[model samples]
Target: MDLLKKKIQDEGKVLSESVLKVDSFLNHQIDPILMQKIGEEFAARFADAGITKILTIESSGIAPATMTGLVLGVPVIFARKRKSLTLTDHLYSAEVYSFTKKETSEISVSKDFITSDDVVLMMDDFLANGQAALGLLSIAEQAKAKVAGVGIVIEKGFQNGSSQIRERGFNVESLAIIESLADGQVTFKEEVVSR
Candidate 1:
């Protein structure tokens, strides 16, 4: 997590008070080594949760989710933003609004990948508005799957996403939480150590 924080500090671009672009080493051009480390960390955090599957959205969430699945020895399922001809009609769908894109899209997951008996762990690249995660959660609920927790790579803490998820009674773990991005500066929420 320190490595990730350092990476953000070094290469992350502050586009504005509400946007921090980490495409250099995260979503756009990925760092496998860092992703592996992130996966291992998520696995460690959710080691005893009896996770049967890892759920994520397409594109950005795939890398970290795949790595987490590898480390946890579980299969990864990603929700598709766009429906294709090959995708079957039998799918669980939900509407999600992207904070960055500022548009709404329907995300869907095949019913064959998830089941009522499975314990699912949701993973994402960023948690700003929590819409994507919520959509994934809706899919899981539709499948009657038990959601163990959510693992986020970076959380914009200034947003209400994490709190919304927590209020819904799900455990949310974030690798790096930005408390603020005011004036093109990144500030993180201090980790509280429990004695």
Candidate 2:
């Protein structure tokens, strides 16, 4: 994921000591090539997990989830932030506090998309507070689905989210881990060579 790490370092902006704005190529105006590469990376990491579905929250997680689905040849199931007209009555929901937006939001997914027979690989653009991931995990649990793993594009290592998820005993992999964003500087964990 050197390409992504380099792109972030070159174009990403440090909004504050706690935020790294990668809108230039990640969250906003995305680079399709990089996204495909990221998808492949996630697939490779979780290849042995026998993933049957790719789960993600709506908005930021869509692109990454779609790519993962495409690469892994699995269906991408995203949880909607709000109840929509197209949604069915049978659903699994969880409340999550978004640290970035400083607000609480509920994410929901139809029970039909998840089942006890499936193994889910959760993907996301960022992992800060880990609330979103927790919410997804909750939904998976309700459906009795086995969680294969968690794949994050960028994890804020300074935050407690990643550690919290790890403590729960599930495998969590992050492409780029930010050690800190202090002093208006963005520092990332040394790039890991994908095996």
Candidate 3:
């Protein structure tokens, strides 16, 4: 996680007060070695939950989620933000608001991918208002699947979303949490694991 924090510090950019873009290494062009490390760490953390599947949203979350699935040897299911023609009515759905995009959208997963016996590990690239995680959790609920835990790459700790998710009694782990981004600087939570 120290490596990840350092990567963000070295290459991440703040697009606004709410969006921290890591398009160089995370949200866009990816570094697979680093991604594999991240996947290993996450797998180690949630290894006892008996996870049967990895769930994530489209675009950004796919990389880490897929990495996690590969490491765990489980299937990775990505919820599509943009519905396609091949989608069927047998899908579990939830509406999530994107604080970055400044709008709400529906994220859905095929019912065949998740089932009642599944213990889902939800992963996302960022956690701000918790909308994306909430939507994924909603889908898990609808499927009657148990949420094993949630893993986040970067969490804006100053935001209310992390607290809301914690209040739900789910195990939440974030690699780097920014306490503040004041004065054109990124101030992260001091509890970061030492390298």
Candidate 4:
């Protein structure tokens, strides 16, 4: 994850004390090589979880989740923010508040994609308020799927997201955790070696 930390230091922009924009490489215009590395990291971390599927939200979370799925040889399922006509009524839904957008939206996943037999590994680009992960967990619960773990690319450690998820007994792994983003500066928490 040193490579990822270096990438953030080189390209990430701290918009404010609470926002770090990494659209240049992480989310908007993705760096597939970095994503592949991230996927490999997650695959290594959760290698013994018996994961059957990777789950994430639509849009931002899809890239990393897909890459992780590819590495783990598991299917990826993303929760759609907007319900479409093509989707059937048999779905599991939850309301998630976006830390960046500052709005709440209903996220849904088709029941057919997840089932009781699945051991799901949830992945996301960022973890701020833990709302998205919570929503995904809700969906997984609705399907009776066992949550294997959560893999996050960037975690805002100043926030309570990580602790919240941990309190719920979910094993959460974040590649780079920002301890502070004060005065447009990014400070990371001491990296825990996890090869």
Q: After superposition, how far is residue 51 of candidate 4 from its true place, in Å?
A: 0.2
Better model by TM-score, 3 or 4? 4
Which residue pairs show collisions in model 2?
Answer: none
- Looking at candidate 4, the ten consecutive residues that score lowest on lDDT are 80-89
Mind giving the per-residue lDDT tens digits that candidate 2 earns over 59-120?
Answer: 88888889889999999998989533345479888888876677787788888899999999
RMSD of 4: 1.8
- Best candidate according to lDDT: 1
Runs in model 1 lying further than 4 Å from the true structure: 83-88
Better of 1 and 3 by lDDT: 1
Q: For candidate 4, write residues 20-44 as lDDT tens digits.
A: 9999997799999998999999999
Candidate 2 vs candidate 4: the lDDT winner is: 4
If scored against the real structure, what TM-score would every candidate get? 0.95, 0.94, 0.93, 0.95
List where candidate 3 sits over 4 angstroms from the true fold: 83-88, 192-195
lDDT of each: 0.92, 0.87, 0.88, 0.91
Identify the superior model by lDDT, candidate 3 or candidate 4. 4
* Model 1, CA-based lDDT: 0.92
Report residue 10 deviation for candidate 2 (angstroms). Answer: 0.8
Give lDDT tens digits, candidate 3, residues 1-88. Answer: 7899899889988776666788899987999998998998888888888999999998888888888888888999999885333455
